[model samples]
Target chain A: MEPDTQNGGGMAKLGIWLVVLLLIIGGIVVYGKRGEDTKKASVKEPIKIGFIGPLTGDLANIGANTKAAVEIGVDDINSAGGIGGRTLEVVYEDSQCTPAKSTSAANKLISVDKVAAILGDTCSSATLAIAPIVEQAKVPLISYASTAAKVSDAGDFIFRTVPSDVLQSSFAAKYAVEKLAKKKVAIIFVNNDWGLGLSKGFSEAFKAGGGEAVFSEGIDATSKDARSLLSKIKAIKADILYLLVMPGQAEIVIKQAQELSLKISIFGADPLEDMTVWNNAGKAGEGVMFTTIGTSPSDDFKAKMKAKVGSDEIIYSGPFAYDGLKILGKVIGEVGTDGTAIKDALYKVSYEGGVSSPKIEFDQNGDPKEAGYAIKIVKNGKPVVVK
Target chain B: MDIVPQLIANSIIAGSIYTILALGFNLSFSTGKFIDMGYGVMMVIGGYAVFYLSKILGLPLPVGILLGLVISGLVSYLAYTVVYKPLRARKASGAVLLIASLGVLTALQAVIAILFTSQFQTLSGLLSGNRVFEIFGGAITAVQLTTLALGIFLFVILAVILKYTMCGKAVTAISDDEEVSKIVGINTEKIIGSVFFISGVIGGLGGMLIGFDTGIEPIMGLPWLLSAVTAVIIGGIGNVYGSIAGGFLLAFAENFGIWQIPGEWKSAITFGILILFLLFRPRGLFPK
Candidate 1:
C-alpha cells in the first residue's frame, strides 16, 4: 500500500510540472507576440517609463495624491502634441513604501517592462533600495518625493526633484531657534533612512545653532502605540518634540501625544503635508507645524488635480511629481529614449514656470539646484504656509 | 522615575490586547491541532466589516459590531468546512494544513485591501472624543480600558466554559485523542466548528477594540498574530489560563525592557524572551 501511494504521489508531481511547463511556454508565446505588435506600431508606440510608489499600505494616501498629479502630468504632455509625435505613457508599480518591495519592483521594471527611464519611489527608503538596481541597469531613476541626503550619493543615474533633508533640517533648526525660540528638542523618528537622516541632520544643525537635543530615539515606522515612547520623551521635558513619521502613523502620534497631554510643541517633517493627517488628527493636529520643500503648483494644475481626485487638497509632493514627469518627458524627448543620454541630458536641462519650482535644474550630485523651505501649520483642517 | 507608572500602565494596556488575541488563538489551536495562520485575517474581516457597515453605511455601532462578529464567525467556520475539513478528511499532514491556512491568510488580506483600499482607518470617530483616564500616572483611553475589561471578562467566561461545559469537554476529548473521541461517539467536527466560531468572535472583538485604540489596516492583523502566537507559546501552548499570564508577562517585559534602551529594541526583546523559553522550556511555563 505504501509503494502504491508513493507511485501515486510521483504521478501527481509529474502532472503538476507538466502543467507548469505548458503555462510557461504559453506565456512566452503571448509575450513574444505582444513585443512584435509594439514593434509594428513603432511610429507612435508611446514612450513608456516606470513609476514606483507607495500605492498601498500606510502611505497609500500620499501615493494616491502623487499618482493623480503624475497622471495629470501625462495628460498635459499628451495634449501638447504628444511629446514630439510619440505619446508618453507611464507603467506604475506599487512599492508599498517598503525597501524590499521597491527593490523587486525596480527589477521587474528594468527587466520585464524595459522602460526607457524610471520615475518615483516616493519614500526615501524605497528610492535608496532601488538605487543600486537602477545604477546597475543604467536606468535613469528620477524620484519626485525622496529627500534623504544619502540619495544624492546613491548613483549617477539617481536623481530627485525634492531637496535633501540636509537642507530642510538646517532650515528647520534655524527657524526653531531663531523664529520660535525653541532651545531643547526631543526627537522621535521612524527608524528608517529618511528618519535617521533627518534626526541626525536636525540634531547636528540644532547643536550648531546653539540649541540642545535633549532626547532622541527611533521607533518602528509601523508602530501603532507610542505611549511608552511618549512617556520617555515626556520625562525629558523638552520644549519641542520633533517627530519624523509617515502620514497615517503621524496622526496616531499626534492624537496619542495629545491624549498624554505632553506639554510641548510638536514639529514634523514633510509627510505631515498629507491631508489625511489633518483630517484624521482633527483637533489634535491643530497648530502642528512641519517643514516641507517649498512648492507652488500652478492654480490650473491645482484645479486639474481637484477635478481628477475629487478634492483640492494636494500632498506637498504632488507638484514635485508633476514637475518630475514633465522633466522626464522633456529629457526623453530630446535624448531619444536612451537611459544614459537621458541621465546626461538631465544634468544640463533647465525649466521655467514648473509647478514645483520657478526654475528647476539638477546639480552635480543630481540634487535639486533650487531648494526653498516652507513651514506650514495646520489650522481648521488645512495646512497653510507660515510666512 | 515619574515615567515608571505610565510605563506600567502602558504595559497593562498592551498586555490586555495581547491576552485577548492569545486567548482566541489558543482556543482554536487546541482544538484544531494545527497552526491556522488564516486566523489573523478573521480580525481583518471583522474590522473591515465594521468599517463598511458602521462608517460607510451609517449603521449603528452596536449593530455593526454584532454583524461584524457574525460575519467573522461565518467566515472562520466556512474556512474550516470548505478548506480544512476536506483536507482533514484526506488525512493531510499538519504542515500542509498550516500552508493551506497561510494561503487563506494571504488571499483574504488581499481581498480586504482591494475592498478597503489599504488606508489606515479609525473607528473612534463614532465617539465625540476618546475619553482619557489616568491610572498610576499613565494615560489610557476609554477604548483601551474597555479592551482590558473585556480581556479579563472573556478569560473568566472561557475558564468557566472550558472547565464545566459539555462542548468544552468534547473539545478536550478530541484534543486529547481524536480517534478515541470518535470511538466514544463524540461529534468532534461539530465541536471543533463551534470552537472556531467562538475564537472568531473573540478575534472580532479584539479587532474592534484595536480599531478603536489605534486604527485598522489590512496588514494590522499580521503583527497581532505574531504577538498572540508568542504569548501562547510563552504562557503554555494549548493552555487557556496561561495565555492571560503570558500576555501580561510578555507585555511587561517588552515595555520595561526598553526603559533604558531604544524603542526599536521592543521586537528584539519580545523574540529574545520567546527564544529563551523555546530553549529552556519548550513546553512553556505552564505545560499542558
Candidate 2:
C-alpha cells in the first residue's frame, strides 16, 4: 500500500510536468504568429505619394483637372493589383498657385507624411519653391505642368512630364519669324516665373533667328488694366503682339486690345488654347494663335478624362499629369519605394504608352527627350490645329 | 504714335475707377470709424450678382444691373445688421471690428470661390459691342467714357449733398462724433446703415464698370481696395473730395512712373509714391 501511494504521487508529478510543457509550446506558437503578423503588416502598408497644386486659388481649374487625371491613373494602377500587391494612396495639398503656400505644403508632405514621391505643383512659381525642398529630401518631384525655362535647372530630383517653355518659346519665335514673317514683335507677358521665362526664351530665340523684339513688358498677373501697357506696345508699332499670359488674363488683354482698335496680330503661349479664351474674348480671339506642347490627346484618354472630370474641357496639363503618375507608379514598381532607387529607375525608364506622347524618356536635365510643340489657331471660338 | 495722349487717357480711366472705389471706402470709413475690410468683397458680390442675374439666369441687362445694385445695397445692409451692429452693441474696439471685417472678407471670398470657381469673367457681352472713340491720338472705349462720366457725376452729387443737405449734415455730424450725434437726437445706427448702403451702391457701380471695361474675378476686389485705401490715406481718410484728388494723383504717378522704367516696376513705383507721400505729406494733397 505504501509503494502504491508513492507511485500515484510520481504519476501526478509527471502529469503536472506534461501540462507545463504543452502550455510552453502553445505560448511559443502564439508569439511566432504575432511576429509573422507584424511582418505582413509592414509589407501590406499602402504606398503613399504626395500631390501639390493650386486646388483652391486662381489656377484651380487646371489643378482640379490634373487631379482628376491623376485619380484615373491611380485607379488604373490599383485595379491592376497595384504596385507589387500593395495599395497605392495619394495625399493632396493645395498650393494656391503661390510660392509661400507651396513651400509649406511640400514641407508638410515630406516631413509629416513621409511620402516616397511627389507629383505636381502646377504653377512654375510653386514648383520652383518646392524643388529645393524635395531635392534636399532626396524625394523625386515630377511636375506635371510648370513650364518655366529655369525649371530645367531646378535639381537632379526635379523632373516634369510637360516640356519646358524653352521648346514652346522657340517654336513661337520660329512661327513669328518664319511662318508669319513678323520681324518686329511686341512681347507682353504675365509677371511670373513662367511668363518671364517665356519672355526671355522668346526674345533670345527671336533675336537669334533674325527677328527683332521691339518692345517687351511684363504685366503684373494681378493687374486688370493692361491699357497702359497696350498703349506702350502700340507706340512701338510692332507687327505682332506675343502674349505670354494665362487664359483669363489673355482674354482681358485681347478684349482690351480690340476695344482700343489695336489691329496688331496676337500670338500667345499654350494657356490661350483653352475654350475660356474664346468664350471670354469672343470675336476678339478669332485670329489668335498659340504654341502648345504635346500632340493631340488619344481618343481613349480623352474619353476617360471626359468621364472622370465630367466635362470635355480638360486643361492642357491633364494628359501630362496622367502620364506623370503612371510613370511614377511604374518606376516605384520596378525599384521599390526608396527615393534614390526610384529616381534612378525614372532616369532609366522609357515609357511608351502614356497619353502625353507615344514615347517619353528623360534626358540628363530631367526633361523629356521627345517634347515637341504644336501651333494652334482660334477659329469660330474654337481652337483648331494649324496645318 | 506718341504715348503721351494714351498715357493721359490711361491715367484718367484708372483715376476714375479709383475715385469711385475711394469714395465708397471713404463713406464707410468716415461714418463707421473703422476700416471695413469686408467692403472689398462687396465689389465681388456686385460683379458676381450681375453675372448670375444676366448671364446665368438670362435676365435683361438693365434688369440685371438694377437688381445687382439693389442686391449689393441689401447685402451691405445685412452685413451691418448681422456683423458690425452686434459687435458695436458689445462696444467692440476698432481693432476687433477690423479683425471681424477681415473674417467677413475671407468668408465671403471663400464662398464666392466655391460658387463660381475663381476664374476671371467678363461683362463685355452685355454691352453688345464696345465702341472705341479716338481722342487726341489716344483711344478710349465707351465703357471708360461712361465710367468717367459716372465718376464725375457721383463726385459732384456727393460733394453737393455733403455741403448742403440735411441728411449729409447728419452723416457728417455722426462721423465727427457718434455719441454726441446720438445725444443730439440723430439716429446714429440708421445713419451708419444708410452710409453703408450708399457705399455699397457706389462700390457695385465701380465693379460693374470695371467688369465691363476689363473683366472681373473673385480676387478683383483686393486690388481695387488696395488702390482705394491708398487714395483715402493720401487724400485724408475722412474727406470725400480729397479722395478724388488723391485718386487722380496716384493714377498719374503710377502711369508716368512706369514710362521710363520697365512695366514690372509699376507696382514698385506705386508703393514708392505711397511711401513718399506718407513720409513727407501725411495729410496728402487737398487735406481735409
Candidate 3:
C-alpha cells in the first residue's frame, strides 16, 4: 500500500507538468493567430460597402433589378484587379421601401458592418430617412434612384445618380405648355414625397409658363379604384392630364380613363416607361408620352446586362445604379476608405464612361450637373425615344 | 361637373360590392360565433383561382368563375373541418378561435403570394370591352351594373332561404343555440358547415366580380374584409337584412362625404361612419 501511494503521487506530479507544457504551447499558438488576424485586417481588409433597398415587400422586383445591376458593377471593378488589391464587398439589407425599416438598416450598416460608404435606399422616402444617419456617421450615401428634390437638402453627404424631380417636372411642364400647346392641365398625383414634389413642381412651372392647372388632386398610392376621381377629372375637361403615379397604379388609371371614354391627352413621368405598364394597360397605353433621363450604355455593357439579368428590357434605374457603383469605386480607389475623404472626392469626380450619363460631375448639393431629360412616347405598344 | 349624379352612381357601385361581402360575412359569423379572419384570405383564394384559370389556363370566363366558387367553398369547408371543428371539440374560447383564424389568414396569404407573385393582375381580357351607360347624367359600366344586379339577386335568394326554407330554419336554430339544437337532433355541425359553404360561395363570387371590375392582387382581401365588417357593424351583427341596409348607408356616407373633402379622405370617411354608428346606434340600424 505504501509503494502504491508513492507511485500514485509521482504520476500526479507528472500529469501536472504535462498540463502546464500543453497550456504553454496552446497560448503561443493563440497569440500568433491573433497577431496574424490583426496584420491581415490592417493590410488586406476588403472595402465593405452597405446596400439598403427593398429586397421584399411590394417593390421587390425593382430592388432585385437594382441589386443585380450593382453586382455587375462590382464584378467589373474586381475583374480589373480590385482597388489596389483589396476586394470590394457589399453587405445588403432590406429597407422594405419604408422609412422606419430604412432607419434600422442604416443603423446596422453604420454601427455593425462598419461600412466605408452606403449605396442605396432606392425609394425617395427611404433615402431621406437614411440621410441623417449617414451624415452623422460622416459616411457618403449615393442613391441610384431617389429623385425627390428634398434629397438635395437632406445632407452634405447625400448624393444621387438620378436627377431630381424638380428638373423632370419643370421640363415636363415646359413640354406640355410649349410643345404640346396644352393651355389647360389636370393633374392627378400619388400622395407621397416623390409624387407630391412632382405635383407641386409641375403645377408651379405650368402656371409660370402661362398655363392653368384646371384641377389637382392627390390619390393614395395603394388605392386601386380611381373611377370616382376620373369622373371628376372628366367633368373638368382639361386639355392634358398629368398622371404622376407608379407603373402599376398608372396602368389602372390609364385603363379606367379609357373605359370612361375621356379623350384628353395623357402624360406621365419616367416610371411609366415600363413594359409591365405597356403589357397590362393593353392598347390604352398607346400614344402616352413621358420623360426619362438619357442613358449612354456601351454595346458591350448592354450585352453583359442582358446576359446577366436574362432580359433586354433593363429598367432605367439599372444603368444609373451601375454608374453609381463605378463612381463610388473610382472615388474609393483615389481617396482610400475614409468617409469624409470619399465625400470630398465625389465632388471632384469627372467620370467619362458612366453607363447612364456620359459625363458625371457633382454640384454643390451632390447632384449631377450635366443631366438632362428626354421624351419617350409609346408607339405600337413599345416605348420609342422621341427625337 | 355637377357632383350629385356622380356621387349617387359611385354610392350604388360601392354599395353593391359591400352588400355581397356583408351577406357572406353575416352568414358565417352568425353560425361560427367568431370573427373568422380566414374569411378574408378565402376571398383572395377565389380571386387567384379565377385568375389562374382564366388567365393562365386559358379557360372560359364562366367556367373559371364556376371553378373559383367551388374551390373557395371546398377550402372553407376544409378550414372548418381541419381547424375549427377540432378546436370546437376541445371547447376553445371565441378569442382563441379568432386568433387561429388570423393565423390561417396570414399563412394562406403567404402561400398565395408565393404562388402568384405579389403583383397587380387585371382581368381585362375576360370582359372583351367595357360598355358604359349614362344614368341621370352619371356614367356607369356594364360590370358595375352586373354587380348591382348580382347583389340584389343574392339578397332576394338569401331572404327567401332564411324566411321560408327548412335549411334556413335549421341554421338559425343552430346559430341561436348550438348545444340545444344538437340535443333536439338538428345536426348543428352539418348546418354550420353548410352555412360556411354557402357563405364561401357568395364571398367568392364577390371577389371574382371585383377582380373583373378593377384588378386583383394577393393582398386585395383585407380591404374588402374591412368594408364587409363595417357594413356588418352598421347593419347590426348577425342580422342578414340589416347588412344589406348597412352596406348602402355606409357607401352613401363615404361617397358623399368625400365629394367636398380630398379624395384621400375616402377611406377615413368609411371608418368615421362606422364610429358614429357604434357610438349612437351600437346595436346597428336593424338588430335581430
The most accurate candidate by lDDT is: 1
TM-scores, in order shown?
Answer: 0.95, 0.92, 0.89
Clash pairs (backbone) in predicted model 1: none
lDDT value for model 1: 0.89
Scored against the true structure, residue A375 in model 3 reaches a CA lDDT of 95
Supply the TM-score of chain A against the true chain A for every candidate structure: 0.92, 0.88, 0.88
For every prediction, compared with the true complex, DockQ reads 0.68, 0.48, 0.36
Please, what is the whole-model Cα lDDT of each candidate in the order they appear?
0.89, 0.87, 0.86
Task: Estimate the lDDT of model 3.
Answer: 0.86
**Candidate 2: misplaced stretches above 4 Å?**
A1-40
Instruction: Supply candidate 3's per-residue lDDT for A25.
Output: 99
Backbone clashes, each candidate: 0, 0, 0
User: What is the Cα-based TM-score of model 3?
Assistant: 0.89
**Which candidate number has the best TM-score?**
1
| Runs off by more than 4 Å, candidate 3 | A1-46, A56-58, A107-114
